[model samples]
Target: MTSSPEPTYTWGTTSEINSFIRHLNKSHRILALCGAGLSAPSGIPTFKGSGSYWKNHKAAALSHPETFEANPGLVWSYFAERRRLALCAEPNKAPRALAQVARKRKGFVCLTQNVDGLSQRAGHPKERLFELHGSLMDIKCSNKECDYIDKENFAEPICPALAGDPEQPSSFSFSAKRTFTTQRRDATLSTKPSRTNAHEEYKYKREPNPLEALLESLSPTITPEMRQVVIPESELPHCPKCDSLLRPGVVWFGEALSKPMFDEINAWIEKEKKLDLMLVIGTMAEVYPAARFVHLAKEKGARVAIINLDAEHTGGIGLGKNDWMFGGDVEEVLEVLFEGVLLNG
Candidate 1:
């Protein structure tokens, strides 16, 4: 792949993009590989990125099977917060557009790495969608014998221990060069230094990474004392039949996707002699198996297009001169990309 776009052309959005859109409209079989970026517009924090510091612990730390085994309470709490936010989020335009198109299109499949279920909320057909990472809304038993599973269990908090837990802090990190004071922000003396007079303005320079930002974002909702909360064994959610511990259904760090999903994908590939179009939407096709689909599609005479935020995104892996890269907010890109195809008339 060419490393960089020419200086004369900013992100390589030439008239050729129109030709690509025209081709997409005519295509019969299409595949969209989606990721966390698809749901970011709905005020949800991505689990894989730097912004995923849940209560001062790295997302990678809390999402691992090892962490869940040691402290189920703490792990459950992290998911509870994520679930709360996910339920509150409305499906954005990108999902709605995809759903509308999938309704009319016969050979479209969406394989998503997101667990938020936003696409389902947008009325995407169940048979056409595959969730690569298991949903947060599911709960399952740890014991393989029991194999107890509850799907779409939207019950708040999942258990009593997680009930009434404080909300997640701000999802962003800001940089401040110098201290600033505002009389209007915090009326109470809680945030203000005790040494400063109430009537006077107080300026404190806070360099927030993970730990430092914890106070400002959590305080008033989640107190500093609650940072290292660990639920008792009895309080953590357990299975009803086998009496084993219950766990979130998401794919952890050292887990493989279920075999049935692979079978479904295999059938899809075998059914088509040639895939007409492949859209890598909101995902860096860097991850395995899923990423390989992009290469396979291109190999089978499919026109590849990437819809993401970065123009020079080589991470999509299989992109080349013949492929198209529409760089922008995914919602905006999808809205334009599917304009003619989404029309019911």
Candidate 2:
């Protein structure tokens, strides 16, 4: 016998959405999966849309081991710009609602693919929140030999050594109070023959030459006669202990999700036996492992609700009864989705 098609819901009225929200709040074990879309309402751009930053340049091009290996400066410059932008962004209503529910309810948990810490900024505790893709706020030593990861490192801007030029050293700027220094490697003021653009070096996938590497280790300074002066390796921000390059603490396209985070999610699914509800907010369910959560929740008998700006691409993705779609501004829709649920408390 053939099976029937899965049913999907699209609520049209406030009352209906409120009714669902009421039902949703009644769920004992709630799992929420959030993505880049969750931060769009906060003026941040998503990764795969028209206005997305990644659309202009292939995301895979700049975020990879090869790119970092070719020119650590370029990679660091890109991530430093991301860090700069994230520092200026604030959490929107969607995050606020998720945080409120997670905090108010007993069995609420969140798994997010965002590097931005908007969820945490919206008041979700670190323990209850699992950033499966890692975070921009966290910095890790790039040296494979060093096991140093600093969660407190919120430092911004490319180091002067890696700064582009005088006019646009980088999209961001670093704090002067924090001096760039290292004890592992000796650095001195030096110069070499001029060469190709740093951006082109990666665009063509060419290995950086010895002089370029040495220049990359020099800090940039601006003087009246010279637009930008190149200082020494003493200016590159290196790991305090190992004195290696510091990289953004994010799970790149080829990297695995955090082991602890994966364990926690698996344990939750195994322990609960029946996950009551799965709230998928703002994501298109594109990437893996984490992307499979919706299906897993459905298999485990949990109702799934997806809220995104576009619904056409989401409805046919194996959703079932009690699986609904809310297509609109996440903040506006969430205002109604959580109305009576929060007010009644």
Candidate 3:
């Protein structure tokens, strides 16, 4: 016969809360993996949900290497707005909330997937923090020969050309406009169905080619109102060393993470030798590499603690009896975890 399910402690229930408090106080090594959900209360949109569009382009589409190579101005426009939004968003109260615990627990490490720089603003110790995804605030040269890179730059409008409201009337070359309009008129939208365009639907089915991307963007499936920026390539941010095009420092799809940074993180893990706790916050570490890290920590004896907004979805992920799941707002969960629980490590 099955024995019983492991106890899942939510924000409520005094007994469970106290037990977690004891766990936090006794743990020697703790790691927290943060995600986009952590910044939700801070007014930063995840941009992963349906209908997240900018000038008829999805956030992911504009962030790709192919898109940037084809239309640097358009890609820059999207990222510029995102950077502005990130800067404008204040670190959530829960943000500083984690900072307090990290400060108290010397062995505690925070591994955040967000590139918004909120963790830094919240005052988490740099040595103890691991940014799996780099920050949007940083800048780097796109030219292969150029070695230009800048970190933690909060300056607005990064460049003069991307300045002004991003929602203003956009400009596209006559040829591009003509191609887009001609495609729209030629295709029959009513005949096709799906949130994605025909090209997107069959991307994996077809062989890879640069010509396909160009044709897809000009496809009728693109939002009828999609607009492209007019800023010439010459005016975009350029590398001081080679005057080459500049790109966001954040990692894009199909890009490898910084090896040096990973080395530092690996060193930290090896030095610690074992983990007592791993706070899974905001994000579900389901993807590989990131998931691999969490798996390693668990193998090293870390108990998983998930703190997220979705209670129903998180309830039954087959957590071991030793693990804890805190289902509720991040701020509330953090309050329960730190405040009134334990002040010092």
Candidate 4:
């Protein structure tokens, strides 16, 4: 087979990528698989890249059932904070370009690993785009028994325990002077309690000072009455009949990808009319099953183009043979490609 000519522009430059866009316009079916890097320019940090925020914490601890079993409240809190962060971030230019391409093209599908829902926000047709990792904007009941899946604004009220008890209060109050430190690996932050019970005595020490006096000296920073929210095994949300705690619907580490989701993707790929080209943007191309799609597309004789900051062309997929690998910021590279070739065409 004759190899495609190598385009001669530096990655992320407009000059060379425009040539590539011209190449893409000839194809009818285009499939794009996006990853965290695509959203980096929109202020969303890449999940596993250099300077990624998740580098410090153990990802397993946050997503595994074992960790949630040990402390569901803690896990929920962590995810809630993540939801807040995602809400604040906006979709970048890459998604906008993908959306534009999808609108103009007859057969375009986008499969994304990001949970930020930016692709949809960028005006991509929801029917044509698939979120492989699920979404951060959605919330489901922690009780397996309850079918309480609902759309939530980032600032929803926590379960009562998380909010603390209003009726019965504890003598031991939280100190305002407490400071928190976030883990470097994941988005988890640890707050150190100021007071620890030195004596094994379960009872509060009788220091004869009135509660009012204690309250007066305390800094306004501390909310003494606040109780830590903990999801107990006994109270785990469950199916009404089965009584199971409904857990977060996210795909966790070491867990198999959802079968139905896999089926949908496979069906799309298996259509009699094979794709004309496959565009992989912003991914390291390391993860499973998703990575296999590119290989399958290439096997079926579809041209492949990869755009990423740090990507490797493993599996002997030669770049010269109807394949191009461009490395750099996805947004900038796409801007150049779209403006110079796609839009102009």
Candidate with the greatest lDDT versus the true structure: 1
lDDT of every predicted structure (CA atoms): 0.70, 0.63, 0.68, 0.58
Ranking of all candidate structures by their lDDT, best first: 1, 3, 2, 4
Q: Model 4: how far is 159 from its true place, Å?
A: 5.3
Clashes of 3: 0
- Model 3 lDDT tens row, 1-345: 999853333333555566777888888888788876688677565544332456556655666676777778877887887787688878986778888777877888888888989999999998888788788989999986787899899999788887866576433223322332232233323344332333232211111222233243342242323335457888999888888899998877656777888888777777766888878887666654666667778878888888765433442234788777665567767876787534544
Q: What TM-score against the true fold does each predicted structure earn?
A: 0.78, 0.73, 0.77, 0.68
After aligning candidate 1 to the native by TM-score, how far in Å is the CA of 119 from where it should be? 0.8
Model 4 agreement with the true structure over 1-345: per-residue lDDT tens digits: 999854333342333355566677777777888876687666554433122112133333455555565566655655654555566667778899899888877578898988787898899988788888777765566554466654433443334433433374321111110100111112111332112321121121111212232243233221221123445655543434445555555655545676888788778888856678888887755566777778777766778788765433333344555466665557767876667434554
Residue-level lDDT tens digits of model 2 in 1-345 = 999853222323444475567677678888899876688666554534222222133344456665555556555656666676677788988899888887777688899988888899899977789998888888888887898988946555546554334465333222111111110011111332122221121111111122332232233221232212223335656898888877788876556677877888888787867888888887767556887877788888888788765544573356766667665456766777777667764
Clashing pairs in 3: none
- Give the top-scoring candidate (TM-score): 1
Superposed model 1: Cα runs more than 4 Å off: 1-14, 166-229
Better of 1 and 2 by lDDT: 1
**Which whole-number lDDT from 0 to 100 does residue 251 have in model 4?**
59
Residue 345, model 3, lDDT? 43
| Candidate 2 runs further than 4 Å off | 1-11, 14-16, 52-56, 157-235
The candidate with the higher lDDT, 1 or 3, is 1
What's the candidate order when arranged by decreasing TM-score? 1, 3, 2, 4
TM-score of 2: 0.73
